[model samples]
Target: MPSQITRQITRHVLTIPAQGGKPARKVHYRRCGQGPALLMVHQSPRSSSEYTELMRDWAAHFTCIAPDTPGFGQSDPLPGEPEINDFADAILEFADALGIAPCAAYGFHSGGIILVTAIKRRPQAFRCLAVGGYAIWTPEEMRIFGESYLPEFVPQPYGEHLAWIWSRILEQSWVFPWFDTREEARMSIAHADVEHVARTVSEMLDAGEHYRAGYGAVLRAPRDIPAPDAVVPPCLISAYDGDPLQAHIDRLGAMPASWSAQKVATPKEHQDLSLAFLKEHADTAPCGALPEDGHEGWLELEGGLIHWKGAKGGRLRLHRPAEELADPSKGEIAIDVPGHGQSDDFDDMKRAVEASAEALGVSDIDWPAPPAGDADRLYPDMAPDRFGLYLQRAWQVARAEAFFAPWYEANAAHAVPLTPEAIATPAVHARALARIRAGAAARRWHDTLAQIQGETA
Candidate 1:
């Protein structure tokens, strides 16, 4: 059941111009409400989705805009090894692209580091800032984090990376600096709830090995706080009691007159404090219209927004049942069918596609060829399980699909022409991510495909 708040918020993808020799990239974001612009940045390894409820509440008084920071969610990675400065610059890039004229910003953990750097680089560009936690790590502590934290996350043949990532995130709540299992590192608040752990694990999957760059940048970043007399916008930095960073409030020595730090008793109080601070300082200027490429953008359907790319009247490329939009080079126009990719799930996917086409004025439809004889077997149950097998299952299908027309059939009769690219680690990993992201929605899409083709699902 979708909440009313979820409906009020809308998601979009903006194409940022090429930078530092890198090609143009897509940045996904969530927007809602109608007041002073508030740019919300989430912690590392998590996307804007984590702040859905927070945005909902803040939306009542402010235009909450939270973006999937570069290399985290649907946003593309930076050109190369990005330092704290690169991520900071990326934020300004997003702001300029979206035309949020001097907005108030908020950030948590790694997000806080980036925002701090951004404000220091261009103080006049922001109104104020509300930071959840500000870390002032000592050199010895940074060395320890550098040596033990953020292991290289290379994908494994049997989805071993998936198991490791799930445990890594699950244990993060149990202990600070997850790799430190010692009693001293144990967090005051800890739980192993699968639902919560699953969300972080999925985000880790999206970031892949780039987690090291983002996470490391934060740990290695020096405390960039300015002197009390330095010119800067007003900022409030607060942390909840159980949070590891709550203790770091003491380390923020001699802050500027306009800045203050506090330790709240609970997360609710922490958020309430941040919200109140932002409200006090938030500018009354209007957040400009959301940027959109006239050619490739979201189409608002009755049920939900449909994500489409390329030319509208061009040959419409539909991906496989559980697949997302094909590579842009494959065709002029492609769409992630409802219930797959970034598009929202729908009760009637076939009709949803028709409605999307009608709305886009897309007449030249080019549907995908139905898969060979694979039923629900091709689309397994990918719900979060205690053992984290769903991740491996997606990997299994991804690997098998390369050699056989229907991944379930391994015999020579069903063997397809072998291609090196299909079996490559990166290719298989990409396919597995697509299947994992689709989740049980893949089954619904497969059933819809069967209905369209008049065959068994």
Candidate 2:
């Protein structure tokens, strides 16, 4: 057994041109470790962040790279409703753009289907695959799923879908179809942990309205097992006990000599065996150098990638300033707050701010107050019919002050060292559209605050 190695994980984005003359799509990815590359694809409605822990463990032996599949994270969705093969081809494009090939792969559920399809479409791109769960759904099941499983996941300003999302994630383990309320379909492993629910909600928020396209494609994908005569890369499909796909392993029936299926006692055991198998079949050598961390680029922190601009010197962190209007030249450092601009969001503001500060390589700095009465003005594009516009507006105000909101009063003293020109930096205008896109999360923040105040009062 190889000893576990610690490596600095890095996040970056690259734009890949569309097949036609359409605009390019930006793909965001996280990479770590220092050996042969292992590509990881996450389950639907999730991102590369899902593999952070596993990437850390596998980094000791492989250069683990996890990408946010299109439509699920920062990565852009397909030009139109994609077929499963299109998703698979996108993975190949992702690998080609990064210049890594003949690598091993791992995925979970929808991710498994995507990776398997990718390998089937381009056998030379991968040496082997380890799948956590691979569903082989029947026509009936597919019909049922296609109808309801992935309805348009658009944002409802009032967050009308919040309850549905919460219940769906919580009850998924308890029911086979999740929508089925029949007693016979209930499993024993149902859990309602707040933290877990919050995590799922955060990922869903990241996917927003586009999750339906990606997830729907997988549910509608062909579940064909390679015949013994077909040439395919080595593959291992294992599902942990109690996983919904555990029974589907039997549906795989007869697979090629290069493929194997098993039911693992636990997820951890499954991961261990899969990792070992991938390493055993890995054929490529590591790139020999770790990805460089840039001083003027994005940093992968706990929640999501934190975008930083300006040369390293006197640091000036902008608090919800219009990104386009504020000049990066005015300060040595500037950041896009989580849930704002190019940065990602967390369920909690304190954690977001703390991570940003750490990524900024600053202990403390001058905190400036945001311009008054600008939150609502910044989000003019929000739908008037949205029920939580008020809350979203309030959240925008709090978002501007999130760094200090957790520690100090919103109106507390915030020293202004820079001139009015600096106070009204143009960068603030750059991210207004980004802020509008994050209105759903602002609604979540509203719900969180209501709970907090209700608990205290």
Candidate 3:
């Protein structure tokens, strides 16, 4: 294991009046490194805290600045739910307020959506952009997500909600694997751990009703950034298999020549790859090389040792403070998936799985058998080829028993009042069943069985 990097940095909180009656604002930002400026925009339901570690590393090369977007973390909410354009303008204003001209910007997920919009609106403000997992949902996909926006899976008694939320995210890969390659997809799934998944789910739900509202705003917004063809700066859009944005890669693939696209397995790898590309291609350059630190953590599935400080959260220890990550060692890098450590919301589950797998060197491998006792009895007659599957199923059963059972029992008292027309409705139940069947069919159980047989042989 390599030693982690230790660096000192400063954080500043500025209250910039919103442009044109939007509202007053208090923005907390961290400044580090020396040289060209780099602004990192975090995704929705999260704060500037997401990039603490990455910023320390990147600051070594450029002055890295990360801010909490409006309506997230400590930043004041936008006046009445601003659109993507509002976010773009807010970022532009943030730049001007900080006196950072012609700075390079990077955004992940919804943050990417906002930055791309900003670049299109004011091309001169940014010199380059690196976007991760940009979501461009198809019409039908949007419809499904809109309907399922407030999933009833919020865990009861709070504690179980953690595991419940984690399972919901883990089950998502069965629906979509957005990477450009199988290796990327496999590596991405291998890095998640139960604790990380639980924490992220808990945070998103804790954000109160605003969580659903924020999601609704994005879902109601237009599909593409209003100006897809505006060529202001060199842009790189990257995605991995488990990334929800992976489905939208085709949309980005159609971007004008100024933009480029690639897929990597993990978030840390994506950041490193993007930084290396920027160092080579982007005119704005980093200042100097920084030394490594002594942080160490296990990547759950991938079985690799990741070195960094603030291991519990997303903070990275660096030799010097900078605005963004400097060059890192080649190969996959681990990041805390959302809701765990410093990341916010349930979306971090995908990244966590990938990071854990990478740390543990367990990519594409089956999980060990369930421990002795009740766990063993629960699945005595069933077998799963992948460790994730077993864990996912166990979580689902535990959650259903823990949360839904009491609700169902209590509701029975009102069962007589429940009209025949009101009980979940046959059509809804049918659709749900159909979705389940389709999911099972699409999972290609036979393929997994074949792989298991091959391994045994």
Candidate 4:
């Protein structure tokens, strides 16, 4: 019989007094497991609830602490509309309230931006930092992102725009002109997973409009982190294949000496790498780990966790995946990405990717080559004026398809092969089936001709 996965944990809601003339606010948090301290920060349009599952697995390695950022989840809105820096201050207060003077930290997306800002302001307070898909958009890129990627505020009720919003977030890899390079284009198409996209969409919708503040702040804030060259500490930045931030790898590349960047193909890879790095270096300073369970899966990334062992202490095990061990060039580490398995944070894509690859025992992979052909010309029919909207729609469909394709393919094996009558149930369904059949027939014909020619030779 398999061992039952135990779900041991505790919950707390404490009022953390604001620092520097701000009023106190009720902060909701979850604490579990036993070990060093680790703090988990959630991205925009979501709450700390995102890490609930991933925390289970991490509890074995560290005392996981995940809090709902002010104005999101159960936490109250800030005394006033706050910027990313203000959010960081709230965390500092939260840390003080919990008696965590110096702890390790991890964050994803907007959460990462805040943590990075916090660490820059108080470098000595953190032992190390790991971020997923960190965005350091250049001035030009920020202009484009703001004009296209920022969600428009609509007065329509939540349900009305939920689907549209969800789709927009999911289909980002598809139709988004930002990723014009060949390798990114191919990987984006190949990695589209509709189910995952749908789930992410759903979660965002559930989190509601209050989450928009974080996104807005991220978009408007300047991309500036003073050099940590003087008080450098180990830092990791990671991202997956379809991460929008992947385009700004150069910006992140300029990180201080103590920082490293990596690009990964999936979120799980990011978590594992961050965890391994944290575990290896969790003794030199104070640290905090969130979501204590060693098996609880995280939101979106599924089987993920967060762990902060300390600054530097513990038996460091160098476990690399078999394929990675064979080829030392792959550069994958033997740890899990946060919110994917047993790790946390989602702000720095490159670092996450490199760390994940190392954790998985694979050597680092080269950045993918840009896509071939004229990317701008591919969608001529798309209105130039509304390119962002059109691309956003296309991206939505692509992500939905990516998420659902695997399940659909698996289920197809148990059902009867598609027949004209079966597909004719809906007009849209029939048209899609016809397209599939045509594509399949074309491939078969080409294969048959090749085989015949080979036989004759």
Candidate 5:
């Protein structure tokens, strides 16, 4: 059995310039392992985190690079609702920007479509391609997806969207067109677990409104299979029996000489075959290091990915905040605490804080005193109705004010004000509102957990 030990993954950001003088946009990705390069494109509404297990498994044989495709995950969306070709082009640009070449690629679902299109347009960029599932939607299905499936997901002030999102992800496995309530289309894989629903909902939150662009593009993409006589790179197209795209193997009537399609019995089998195929063709050249985006970004600490926003070389390196949690000076660096802002949380706060400070190149011994007062005083203004939801949103806003505000000021177009109603503060500074919201949500989350534990006890 695999050891199941978590992989040491590092997050990186690369800003790539647009063609024809359009401004450059930031692309975020997670990289792990070594040896031959394998670009992993994730499914819609999820980030590179989806490939954690896969990356760890493949680390022994290859260097796995998974990027959050534009408009989904942490990557910026295209200028507008983009065509599938635009996404394909973005992948090529991403590769060029990173100076990675002679690569093999693997994509799952929508990710697979993007890679397939990328290879179709620029076959030489990759040595081989392996995809989990490739959908060939008919015009009618595309119309339905456009009309109902890919609706713009906006934050509802009352938190009603959360409930809907939870249900949507949970029932997606049970129904073909997730929105369709017809009993005939029900799937055997439908799950009703709350935790599973919550996990996907968190990812949906990360993608926000941009989910439409990525998912929509895939749904609307041209599903052109190469003619038998046409030339293309070596490719393996496989789908598990229950996957909707399994039937697409039939649609791929006259595949290129190098192409092969199969219906696998299980997901493990699909991945095993994919890894074997990619390994067979991998050249294993050492791709150049990822380019650095100057100032304001993430640092992977022992606890989790720490989101820091500031320039290095501050006069006085602030190890942590004092009781008041005051704003950083012109030369100060501020970080969102683990599980606080963009940083992920660890069960042990003290250890996480210590590790985070060290990762940020600050001395752990100089740790500042924590904020004073209890949880209620910290977030006095939060609505009692849905405190947890409000906190999560607020935490993101708080970080934006402290670290991102300066960056945004320099780049005015990137500074989007939090929705007044959603942030629950038309009068407060965006940063203050965020702090209040995070505090409230943290309290609620902890309180709920305690209650559940006590009941079970």
Candidate 6:
């Protein structure tokens, strides 16, 4: 047996074919390890980021591939109100794009719903599946969830949505549906950890209003598993105590002979069982060549992996702190500077930028103009507070910057002229998310640019 070896997870963008009226779009994915491909799908409102640690460990046994489902993470959304099949077919397109068909697979929660549908649609595409907590919702359960589960998540002018979502994701573990605070709704295992809640909140913020579509599609989907007599891939379905979907294991009465459901004592036990099941049934053949991003990818340099897009040399455009690459498709080479966007952190951002330009064979650095205000007041570091107030802070900062040039001075004297579109919800949401995600390093980027510009001047 090959000893477990750690592999660095690499991200790539695969273009899925256009469907319905929607145009073709990029699907961001993470890959690790080397062996037969094992496709993993994540639950709703969360991206493939959930599989990072698992991918690292599983890398020893299989080539793990996980993609951000549409409208989640960096992947784009499908047009209109897409149903279960649309998402299932999208998964197929994703797998086909990589030429990794008939691969071993795993999915959790909403992910289980998607992969189950995909396997049923084309059994030959997968060799086996390991599902975590499959749901077989009763009509009454569906009706109850339908009424209160997915509230339209619109961004509010006063940061009301920020507060609402933070609390909602935080309380999700406290109660089954999160919204229902009644004692009957409480879960056996509950946690109020700031770190865990913050991560879920961040992913939720990333999904935005599109979360409803992905989540609703799964909640309303019919029994995702195929009939007992149907030919399908070898599979194992399991759930642990405290999981809401564990009860649904009993609901899955008649399944294919190759598929079996098990109740585990703990999450670790469930994962352990799934891993063993996958190892036993995993395909022996190695995965084929994977598609690569034409315009955007990570560039390894002195500092860290800097995410760059477009052909180099028109100009090396740099977005200032509290922001990321403005427009990647604007006929200019743009990079998510160190500690910003998708780029990894580096202490000396100036050196990082210089190294990037040198590698890209570009001399022109089109740096963004500096903000006109006290740096201290303008940049708050936007740390995650225990109550998650930092979310609202970032939101307000994004809004404030739009209305006032410095964002600290509330008076009309500092007011900047901008149209309603400039401060629109989507626009501000992007800005706020940037700030929340990378605002801590904004100062380093700002200082780096300032020094470079000062020397040039």
Give all candidates' CA lDDT scores.
Answer: 0.84, 0.70, 0.52, 0.54, 0.69, 0.86
Segments in model 5 whose C-alpha atoms lie over 4 Å from true places? 1-6, 315-329, 347-355, 358-457
Question: Which run of 10 residues does model 4 get worst, by summed lDDT?
Answer: 319-328
Best by TM-score: 6
Query: TM-score per candidate, in order?
Result: 0.94, 0.72, 0.54, 0.56, 0.79, 0.94
Clash list (residue pairs), candidate 6 = 102-125
List model 2 lDDT by residue over 1-457, tens digit each. 3343346667776778656655678787888787888889999988998888788878788888898999887788887778899899999988887778778899999999999998888889998999998998888888888887877654443334545666677677678777888998898678766555555655776687788888988898889877777788999999988888898888898888999999998989999999889989997577554333244467667645667765555465655333321436554677665565556667785466566666566665434444334344433343322233432443343335333323123444643333444224232222323444455553433344345446656
Estimate candidate 2's alpha-carbon lDDT, on a 0 to 1 scale.
0.70
Which of candidates 1 and 3 reaches a greater lDDT? 1
- Candidate 3 local lDDT, 56-82, one digit each (tens): 777556677787776665455566756
**Candidates sorted on lDDT, descending:** 6, 1, 2, 5, 4, 3
Which model is ahead, 3 or 4, in terms of TM-score? 4
Output the lDDT of residue 182, model 6. 94
Better of 2 and 6 by lDDT: 6
* Ten contiguous residues minimizing lDDT sum, candidate 2: 422-431
**Position 379, candidate 2: lDDT:** 34
lDDT of 1: 0.84
Q: What is the lDDT of residue 384 in candidate 5?
A: 23
Q: For model 5, how does the per-residue alpha-carbon lDDT over 1-457 read when each residue is reduced to its tens digit?
A: 2232325677778889767765688898888877777899998877787898899888777778998898776688888768899899999899888877658899999999999899888888988899998888878888888889977677654445555766678778889889998998887667666555555666677677888888888888889876677666789999987787888888777789989999999889999999999888777675556776866577766556766655554432322211112345676666655455456656665566556566656552233432323434333444322223543444444444433333224356545465644345322233433343244334543443344446656
In model 2, which regions exceed 4 Å deviation? Answer: 1-5, 288-296, 300-305, 309-317, 321-334, 337-367, 370-457
Point to the candidate with the largest lDDT: 6
